[model samples]
Target chain A: MSMERAIGFVVGIVAAAVLALIARKIVARRGGATGEYDERQQVVRGRAFTLAYAVIMVYLAVWMVLRNVELPFFNHPSSVLVGILLSVTVFVGYSVFNDAYFRTSDRPGTYIALIGAVGLLNLILGIRHWVRETTLEGRLLDNANLMVAAMMIAVMACVVIKLALDRRSEAN
Target chain B: MKNLKLKSARAGRDMSQQQLADAVGVSRQTINAIEKGDYNPTIRLCLAICKALGKTLDELFWPEEP
Candidate 1:
């Protein structure tokens, strides 16, 4: 790889790590020192993880088969990342529906706001990339921000729906 | 397979599902699931719920034979 590409990759990794730490701090401050899942939530989360792993394995198998079919979009480097994001979305959706996505101390409102903000930001960046694209080859497939935006927005929607269902059930 | 005994016990005390769940360190949904027979709690959780509701495990979780 070129020196500039290597440097950019390293910088991206550092930025991601720093952002993760900041997010953790913010969660700890808003919730508690640590979000504590009850035993039932823990069990549900374990099952969700297993299901997500199975999804990733299935996606990778399909991806391998498609890679040999001369599809330029499927052959993009971001395809693997797409598989990971798909699995993550599955996990999040499952956990949300099962009431295991948020800990007892977690304020779902805070998460909803945070996810909405992040999703909007990624959507803007992804739309910019899409609108300015000149090549038809892997234009959508190579845009990782769009995938991230979609995943985040989908997760947010699932959480919101679950919360609404829970509230209605509680009232009834 | 619903644990109506546990539900009645909790209601007899005028405690909401959320209150009992907080006392037992579980989510309200967990308590709801237990009462609805949607999910079975482990023995440890059963014990915790029993303690929180001031009832014995047999009173709350023991299945009644037909």
Candidate 2:
């Protein structure tokens, strides 16, 4: 992996650890000893994961076909990142909508903030790359990081919309 | 298509869905799904709900003969 990817991976792990710490604090503040992921949540998550697995399988199959046909994106080796990001978006979005990921005791705002933080970080980076590519003759625009950011933003929007709709429905 | 009996039992006890869900250690959405017949709880959860509402498994979960 490139140094950028290596750093990104380490950052991802650190972010996950930080998220766990935050969740622990939330659980403690709520006085819920169980700390989320109850039996029902697990069942929902299982079903969501099954669906996400099917999605990834289909995506990989399409990638294989495109590779055979010598498509531009698949012709390059790094296109696999696209497949992985798609699968991740589907998995996260599915779990978020199904209420399988975040604990009910945890505030929805917390997750929204988390997604917003990541999305904002990516957006800033992607925009900087875009500006460089457009003006000062930098590297190409077909960046995996930017593509991943776009996909994350799309998925985050969907999850947020779904959360709002569910809240409205519950109110009704 | 809900198991109205469970709903009635819960209401009869003056318990809201959220109250029952909290008592049984689940989200309100899960309890709503169970009552609406959109989702089935595991045997363990069924027992938990039964105990929370002071009902037997059959009283809360068994299918009634038409």
Best by lDDT: 1
Candidate 1 chain A least-lDDT 10 residues: A134-143
The whole-model C-alpha lDDT of candidate 2 against the native structure comes to 0.79
In the range A1-172, model 1's lDDT, one tens digit per residue, is 9999999999989998997788768878986537589888989999999999999999999999999996776688888998999999999999999999988888888888879988998999888998888775445876888999999999999999999998898799
Candidate 2 per-residue lDDT, tens place, A56-144, comes to: 89988998998999876687755777777877888778877777777767666655666677678777787777776854223333565
Evaluated on CA atoms against the true complex, candidate 1 attains a DockQ of 0.77
Off by over 4 Å in 2: A1-34, A134-142
State the lDDT of candidate 1 residue by residue for B1-66, as single tens digits. 788999999999999999998898888899998999989899999999888888998898888888
RMSD, one per candidate, in order: 1.5, 3.4
TM-score of chain A of 2: 0.75
DockQ comparisons of all candidates to the true complex: 0.77, 0.65
**Model 2 Cα RMSD, 1 decimal:** 3.4
Fnat, one value per model = 0.60, 0.40
